[model samples]
Target: MQLRLPTSIPEVQECLADGAVPIGGATLVWAAWQRDGFPELAVSLRELPEANTIGAEELGAAVVLHQIDDRVPEVLHRAAAGVGTGAVRRAATVGGNLVGSTLRCLLPAAVVLDARAVVLEPEGHFETDLSDVLAKHHLLVGLRWSAPIISGYRKLDAEAGGPPPFVVASALHADDGGNRLRVAVRDGYEVLSGTVACAEDSADVLDTLHRTDLGTLDPTAWETVRRHVTELLTRSVGG
Candidate 1:
């Protein structure tokens, strides 16, 4: 009902403490509203500060997607743009993407990137790994991640006229950094999360993707879909 925009971390924290939901462009919030309903008191980061800008401070501040977009048009920026359309990007904030847990595609990327987040609790201000923060906190101020060594993102959507990626695999060449593998179901629903130097080969990755968390799919049908996606990813890597 009311929108409060705060320009500083302290101001943002104060508002959060007062129970106002921090808003960053409000894309996910609005989308959910179309599917769900209003949440509670809200705050917009649009005019609050340069939440979109990234740089030394961002690396220091635990740069979020918007912040990365603000500074550079890197891999994450490309992935963020793929989210919906221009209209959505104009309003969406990186922080919102993480806070909205049901959707975990980008968050996993952040995790694989080793991004961290700075939180302002009533007790004190401290930093936590992005994944841990997402699991623990209902409210988040912003996030930060180490710059990727070698990173790429691919999505399969019906609109693309291709089979949805049973697993949207993101690989980061973080050997000197932190080798990580992130695989998630497209459309932000099914998510398989882990950090490993390598998976059980591409076939197993596809198989795991098709199985779903509860093992709900018929094995035959799962194998079909799994094979299709594996071929696709194989072509991708080959190319």
Candidate 2:
């Protein structure tokens, strides 16, 4: 119905407060929203400079996958590179990947990276743990994460061949005590995460996966999910 393209965060917030739905690249829209019909009032984040942050530690919501660089993390780069065709990569935004009804592989990488989200809420803008922003359904503006000592990613393609793949990403970040292991798994439904103090805490990140949350997974889906997670764990510890 109606579309508002705001160039500033305040303007974007205003549009949102006025009941406008936030839109990024709209690539995910065709897959998840087309059948339901589009929202009546929508605001585009594309024109805002803040939504274009592609630096090493920060990634704006509207940042396209093509703009991602090696500086962010190898896991992120590999996941972004495997998402879709070159044209899709050129148009898909990180926000779209994370906020869509499901997800594009990138969400798992963001989770493992322990990324924090910068968001615009009704009260004002604020930064919080990425999981909090996601759980509360806030409008994400950008993401920030530190470089990890080691990072890795793996994806299991959809057999039907069109849907986004199941992905698992891992990162080992240094802490005062030691390097901590962060692992995330993304099925077709959502992204999930877990961690261990170090590689010795557990041989695998299998505990991170909550199968019951997946509802009904046929043997095929479960195996693929398990397979990727195992692959990431293997790579993470050099097994």
Candidate 3:
């Protein structure tokens, strides 16, 4: 296995063009390392061009999940801090999370925030809404998230040992004008994606997403959970 570190977008572009896989913290890749065999070339972005520019405001506030120790205190950040345990969250990155599709909870948040993904493909760079990225299995280079006046994320877990989210939901109301909502269902490898309930459209955007399912929950129990979350988000967002 070979490793290279580049410090500019052009260098990254060249690396990707050479078929090297970009590596952030290597958590996700290492998790499946033996399964797919070690990467022929692992390009570390730690000192290279930073992709966490995707922010909470102007999509420039994105900090790698590990970089959230004391900078941001939002509940979402806290939740991200605890995802997959202390060590993993500290080493796993938001970019890796998306690229590997390891955590479903993050997807709903990206969807609700109307997050956009900037993929440094071998041919050229392209951007796609995070919602669309989550719907497919792709090699994600980085992500961009526009700011939100009000944003929140929610997830439910099973007996507490489930590896991934069962149902996840996120909502964001941007002062820019339009509001956003998203809900996603995950079961092992099968994922279900959907929009919010229409009746709650005008309500606080938060309420719209609360109707979604986020967590490692069983589908049989998703309906009841979904209803409760809907009512709760509705009351909070004044829907």
Candidate 4:
């Protein structure tokens, strides 16, 4: 496999045009290496300074999970805090977490925040809704969001020392004395978003999920999800 260490965004783009897979943090990359060997052409985004920026409303692609801080939104900070242990968090990245795996705690949180991702695609670059971060043949440049969002997130794991099976996140935006809400669920494969107001909406979401991709999820998991969503909504909306 050929390795590329580009120092600037343009150089990174050029390397990518040559078909190099963007690699950040190498936390997930190393894991993939264990499972399927190195990709034929890999480009390291580490040396590109643009990929490491972090702020209240933006986080560059190469920003490590440990770099997220008090300046970021509360829901996102909470999810980042729960991603992995200290050592693992030190090596995991925001972009890699999005592009490499849905199980990463950041997905549902970012979903609820109305996160916008700036991606470097083979044709060019574009920014779009965070839910579509999985666009094929794209490398995430950063994530951005509107300011002053009220949100909440939860990761549900039934067993101690086990991976969380479900993650719930909500964002509430106030405009003209009313609230616009978005609730997101991160399961094993993809994140689901909805505007959940009552028990019926929750029931529909569960039933739909049951009949769809996550058909094998135990009934208890959906029950727990319902309770968890209620708690999140009650707390966020009431406040």
Summed backbone clashes in each candidate are: 7, 0, 19, 0
Model 2 worst lDDT run, 10 consecutive residues: 203-212
Q: For model 3, how does the per-residue alpha-carbon lDDT over 10-102 read when each residue is reduced to its tens digit? A: 787788788887676777677588887898887766654445553343222124675654332243464565467678777776666665645
Off by over 4 Å in 3: 31-37, 58-63, 69-79, 131-139, 160-165, 174-181, 185-193, 196-239
| Predicted candidate 4 versus true structure: per-residue lDDT over 158-222, tens digit per residue | 56656556777767665555555666677655666665323334455445534543344457655
In candidate 1, stretches whose alpha carbon ends up further than 4 angstroms from where it belongs are 30-41, 48-50, 56-74, 159-167, 176-188, 198-239
Q: For each candidate in the order shown, give its overall lDDT on alpha carbons.
A: 0.53, 0.75, 0.55, 0.72
Candidate 4 worst ten-residue window by lDDT: 196-205
Candidate number of the best lDDT: 2
- What is the RMSD of candidate 3? 5.0
Worst 10 residues of 3 by lDDT: 54-63
Q: What's the residue-level lDDT of 223 in candidate 2?
A: 64
TM-scores vs. true structure, each candidate:
0.63, 0.77, 0.70, 0.77
RMSD of 4: 4.5
Q: Is candidate 2 or candidate 4 better by lDDT?
A: 2
lDDT for each residue of candidate 2 in 1-239, tens digit (9 for 90 to 100): 79997898789878978999887778877665678888889987888888888876788898888888886788888888887789988988888777653655687888888888888876688888876766777888998899887788877757665755667677878888776767676766666666666545343344434323432455675565556646655665783
Model 1, 102-207: lDDT tens digits are 5544654554455667666545567777657767763455555555544555555444544433334344444654344443334335454444443537766655
In candidate 2, stretches whose alpha carbon ends up further than 4 angstroms from where it belongs are 30-40, 161-164, 188-190, 199-239
Sorting all predicted structures by lDDT, with the top scorer first, yields 2, 4, 3, 1
